[model samples]
Target: MIFTVQIKVMPLKDLLDPQGKAVMGGLQNLGLNNVSDVRIGKHIDLQIEAENREAAIATAEEAAKKLLANPVMEVYEITVS
Candidate 1:
């Protein structure tokens, strides 16, 4: 079976996100002061070949942990469909 994997990679909450901060600054400059603590993250989409949904989820989780996200600075969430 073929599975669709969706992964979201984001900076750890305790870590500083320069890109997000830059965007937030830009937004505030544009007079969007109501928005606060903006965060930016990466979305990854890929197809995986697996025997079942459970296997596909496991594969994607492993991929996220091993290659897609940096454990030190980033956290990842995986969804398989």
Candidate 2:
């Protein structure tokens, strides 16, 4: 079976996100001061071949851990469909 996987990769909370900060600054410059603690992350959508939903989830998790996300600085969450 083929499964669709959605992965969200984000910088760890304790880590500083300069890109997010820059964007936040831009937003503020645009008079959007209500936004705070902005964070930027990547969304990855991919399809994998697996026998079952569990297997698909496992594969997506492994892919996220091993390649898509930096375990030290970033964390990843996976959704399978």
Best by lDDT: 2
Model 2 CA lDDT for position 52: 97
Candidate 1 residue lDDT tens string, 52-76? 9989999998999999999999999
Tens-place lDDT per residue, model 2, 22-60, is 999999999998999999999999999999999999999
Model 2 worst lDDT window (10 residues) = 72-81
Q: After superposition, how far is residue 74 of candidate 1 from its true place, in Å?
A: 0.9
Name the lDDT value of residue 72 in candidate 1.
97
**TM-score (all chains, Cα) for each model:** 0.92, 0.95
Superposition error at 23 for model 2 (Å): 0.4
How much is 77 displaced in model 2, in angstroms? 0.3
